[model samples]
Target: MSDPNRPGHPEDQPPQGQPGLGPTPPPPPGQYGQYGQYGQYGQYGQPAQPPYGQPPYGGPGPLSQDEITWGSAAHWSALVAAFVALAFLGPLIVMLTKGTQSAYVRRQAVESLNFQLSILIYGIVSLALCLVLIGFLLLPIVGVVWLVFTILAAVRAGQGEEYHYPLTIRMVS
Candidate 1:
């Protein structure tokens, strides 16, 4: 007999052992889609752990030597800004541009900018204090501290170590 409502005609049934009229069986345990085992698709299963020396999930890995060099340069560039009387602009630019590429560079740029901003505030306070003539003594001390700390930051950045500026207000994180 012929059944019009069925997928195949009554005379043309699906091959034996196949799900002719029954629900399809689940795939064998531990086996998934075409890729096979779990974690094959980065989904529907636990993700594979990163090998040793690799960055942890969502964290940046170690910077290369060239990245360290550029990061150090970002710290040192603040000296140019200081000489030009634009202490924050240079580091700000580096932080915005190169920061997207390397986390280390971004960190160095941000620290430099924060330190520069602090120096600017100190310079302004020193100028105001000049009315009492005590700023005359404090201004030189501030300048020396800025120069020395900036150089030390550059050295630390070149060594691929994180550096936070002392006496900085840390306006940027």
Candidate 2:
């Protein structure tokens, strides 16, 4: 009753309790499936390391106090710039320079720049509407909204939260 699929004699049957299955040995000590060795994998069930250039777990940590302060200043600077009629320049400068120092500053600066650019576009449209006298009303409203939201963004930045402006075109990433 030997199996042609098996090399041995008919008496060479699989051990009892292992019918149709020959005894298979376990992997050698310290060797794992494909990964090569045991220690090659961390403690059982532990997650593998992150790929190159990517941050681990929570990603980059929170900003330092100085970074927060500077980031907040970047947001507030837009408000000051508006008074001098150079709203976009403030955040653009902060974004180009201090941006490299802190992720917080970079984000705040970009957000502020986007908001200012949106405001400028709105202002242009409102001025065009002035031909029908609607610009006279819409212009003031736009100004008020810009002023209020810019202040709110500054406050949020001070509190360490990135404030997203409503109606902002987000021209900068």
Candidate 3:
């Protein structure tokens, strides 16, 4: 019932005389089809390892979801600490802990720490300037900048992006 003139029809193809030029050979032994019995997983149900047999070197790998959350927390925690008049404490704590687990989190915490330290320094300088009447304006400006930057950093970290504060003195690597 097949049409003889149709292209790629079984009846229109050349005869399979040589095995090398013919259809693919059946899989050997216990393999089931192209993927075999284990499918994408390697033998014995274990995941397939990288071909190089070693994890990729240089730089921290992709940030996981947990890392991203912790990274954001590293920034937000600064705000919480600020209420207690210890702006550096939050990020410092986060850095000492979660920072060890993720480079991204470490970076966020370090940046926050540096920024908080800078703000503290600025506040001290502005308070000193208050004796000369210039600190009256500078002190409020510093407070506003601190609030704005802390929120900005937290939002950026939550979005899985990095943030750098302006006029910050980086004390930690």
Predicted structure 3, TM vs. truth: 0.66
Q: Write the per-residue lDDT of candidate 3 for residues 1-173, one digit (tens) a residue.
A: 87899997877676564434765343454553244544244344333443455444425467688988998898889889888999999999999999887778888999999999999999999999999999999999999999999999999999899889898998888
Give one digit per residue, the lDDT tens place, for model 2 in 1-173: 54767667566667544577765444465354345333325443233454467663436787688878877888788877877888998899899989887777888999989999999999999999999999999999999999999889988988888789999996789
Off by over 4 Å in 3: 1-61
Position 126, candidate 3: lDDT: 100
Clashing pairs in 2: none
Query: lDDT of each model, Cα atoms only?
Result: 0.81, 0.80, 0.83
Q: Rank the candidates by lDDT, best first.
A: 3, 1, 2
